[model samples]
Target: MRIALNARILQAPRTGIGHYVAELSQALSCDAQLELDFFHGWGWSRQLPAAALPGYNKWTTLAKQVPGAYSLRRQLDQYRFTRGVSRHAADLYHEPSLWPLEFAGPMVMTLHDLTHVHYPQTQPRDRLAEIDRRVGPAVERARFILADSQFVANEIRQHYGVAAERIKVAPLGYAERFRPREAHALRACLAQFGLQPGGYLLCVGTLEPRKNLAQALRAHALLPEALRRRFPLLIAGMPGWRDANLAPELQKALASGAVRLLGYQPDEALAELLAGARMLLFPSLYEGFGLPVLEAMASGVPVLLTARTSLQEVAGPAGVYLEPGDDQGWCAAIQRLLGDQPEWQARRTVGLQRAQEFSWKRCASITASVYRQALE
Candidate 1:
């Protein structure tokens, strides 16, 4: 079987979908029964592009400012994509993002979340409009749809009326690089950022409204002065849309040295960061699948997360759940976890056990099965 995958998401800095495309593609490539061609916007190749390209963000920011720039770019990309698909002679085309190009072949789409539909306020107007226009048609065209979790599969059925049979729940897997690291091994990397092993709390996600980071900031501020000084909150991700909403609490926390913003740590640095962390905090309002929770679990770090959506599914009984908007609750949970070493170690042990259940090889096997079923 031959497949052409839209790997264009890899052109920008990796968030969830970008990581999905990169990891899944590499795993799928190992299947000897299938041949894969990656379409990187302008052309097709057998190899995936680097995780991110230089100046890609600058180019995208500039493109958004010019009128009709996105439309023109899309048209050109579609033309190139159509031509590439013909030459590759693909049996199927997979779109790992919300927008799928015009492809007539058997289509498999990965709907990571319904964030745009559920929380339209979280998205940019133009981008939301584009997704609104294209997603319904794309869903109708696809022979099979892959969702990151059962929560998302249910959302698809509820919102789009996509049948359960046609939607497959293919959970994401963490890379081998996310495993636990010894303190000695993490010393050099952590030293670069002035971090100490097991000395700080971690919140890993893009800064945006949907991440509910302002509440986290408030909750962290509620910590006792000495506790705050000892274990500061560390946020690791790039600035995303509507991040200004977090400014008030963010500024206050930064002033007191109770929180540090480490914008966009690279993939190479993530394992060490996770390893050295006292715990990972993810209070996302919604998620298709909480990859960071899984990665943190795999790194032998306990996680504190919102008990909703796929976060509960991913974390299972291993996570410490907190209400999204309950700053007081969050503060209490943090205090309890820090003070209780036995409970913390127990959570870490279960987290590691839970992480063992998921792997990219399993995800790829399931995805390959979906492809074969689509062909049938």
Candidate 2:
């Protein structure tokens, strides 16, 4: 089968969706029966000049200032990239993001989440409008839909009225790079960030409202002063919309240097960074599937995630779940992890075993099956 995948997400630095595209593309390409083409819509540009490739953090801010920017980009992508897809006459096109462009062949779309629909204010107004206009129609048109988790599958059917039979659940996977590494082997890189193995608390995600970073920061701030000092909070990812609207306690925590924002580390460094952390803190308000939680578990780190959206589905028995507003409860849980070695060790062991259940190869196989089903 010939498959054309929307690879536009790869133009920027990888976040959850970008990693999904990159890893899944590589795995899908390995299939003997499949001929795969990645469509990034670079628009006749031979190569992006070094200066033009801005960092992910800067790109996020730039992408928001212009209204209809995404709609315009997709139109251009349709004009330029679709011609080649037409020439190839691919059997199916897989969109790893929420929506698909106009295509004559059968289409498959991966719906990562409905965060914009549920928490509209958390998204930029223009982007939210664009998603509202495009995603629903695309869901209706798709031959088959791929969801990141069962929770997301239900959300699509309930909210968009997509038929349950047409939607397939294909959980996302962690890359080989997200595994645990020896402390000594990773010490030098960890030292660059002043992070010691099993010492600092880590939070990985864009600095967005839906990630509920403000609340996580508050909970970390409320940690006993001694614990806060010992397990400094480290945040990794680029800023998202309205990131400046932090709570007073979160602001104080940031000012006091108890919370460090290490913006958008490269994917290569993530596993080592995750391995060095004492525990992963992910109190997201909602998620399609919490990739960071799985990454942390895969790295053999105990994780504390909110029991929101699809997180519990992904975390299973490996996560310490809490309500997003439970500052006192979150702090108490952190205290136990800090003080109780036996509890930490048990969770870490369970996390590693659970992490084994997911992989990019498995995700690709299921995705491939979805493509075939779409053709039928």
Candidate 3:
């Protein structure tokens, strides 16, 4: 059957949803029974290679020089797809982002999280509205929906008044980049990135309000001075909006040598860093699924994640859990994880086992099944 995938998010770096689309698409393309067609918007776009596609290519160009044109270009792309989908007559169209609609065909949208729904304050009102408009239609028209986690599925059911039966829960997969590393190799990698081998508590994801990075810094500051020395907070993420005030506080923390902000870690370097870190601390306020928790566990690194939301779901028995907003809670958790080597090693073992349960190939296979279901 012919498949049209809404693969726009694959354009992102190694963040959660982006990684999901990029890896899973490559996996699905491996199946010879399926014919894959993908669409990309925004001029000057390029897709990284995914070998599974039997008959796959992109429609893009470098020249979109139309003046103040990004917005105009995006709208045009939307209209193009509105027209394109009807004529393409794809057996199914899979939208990777939330509320993936505005096309004329059997479509399936992947809702990554309920952050925008649960914490609308985390996203700009105007941007949320734009998303609401696009996704709103998709929710109503799509034959089925895909959610990265059950946490997000429930949110869709509640907010959109969509039944649970209409949505399928398919969690994202972990990358192989997250694997055990030699201590010497880990330090060598960090040295290249100007990262001290041991002076950090790592958190990887976009620097945004939902990530609760500001609160993480504050929690670290509240730690007793002696406890702070072994693990200075290290945040790795690209900057995102609705989080303007956050950067400055991170700046102050950086200036004081209390925090390290390594913006947009190159994938290989990030993999090494994940393997080398004292612990992966993810106290994000919310998530559709927690990719970092899986990454950390896969890397043989113990994790400290928020007890609430999907982090708990993703981390399962492999991680140490604490409340995201509880300053004292993070302080206590971080202290123990850093000081107790035996505890760390024990958790790492369980984490590795749990991490093994998720794989890109499985994600692809299940997604293909979802696609087939949509077609039926």
Q: lDDT for model 3, on a 0 to 1 scale?
A: 0.74
Predicted candidate 3 versus true structure: per-residue lDDT over 225-292, tens digit per residue:
77666577888887775567786777777887878878888778888888888788887877778888
Give, for candidate 2, the lowest lDDT window spanning 10 residues.
Answer: 43-52
CA lDDT scores, all candidates in order: 0.89, 0.84, 0.74
Writing each residue's lDDT as its tens digit, candidate 1 over 1-376 gives 9998999888898888888888998899899999999999868899999768788988778766766566677788899999999998999988998879988778999999999887897665666677898899999889999988999999998999898899999988999899888899999999987878999999999998888878778888889989999999999999988888888889889988889999998897977899899999899988999999999999999999999889988999899998888999999988988999999999999999999988888899999999999999
Each prediction's TM-score against the native? 0.98, 0.94, 0.87
Tens digit per residue, CA lDDT, model 2, 1-376: 9888887776777788888887888788778999887777663221222221356557557668987776787788888777878777789988888657888889999999887788788766777777888888999999889999999999999998988999999888898888888889888988898878888999998877788887778788888788888889998988776778765656788788899888889877877889899999998888899999999999999999888889988889998989878899998899899999999999999999999888889999999999988898
Clashes of each: 0, 0, 3
- Clashing pairs in model 3, backbone N/Cα/C closer than 3 A: 29-52, 99-135, 101-138
| C-alpha root-mean-square deviation, each candidate | 1.1, 2.6, 4.9
Quote the lDDT for 15 in model 2. Answer: 82
Clashing pairs in 1: none
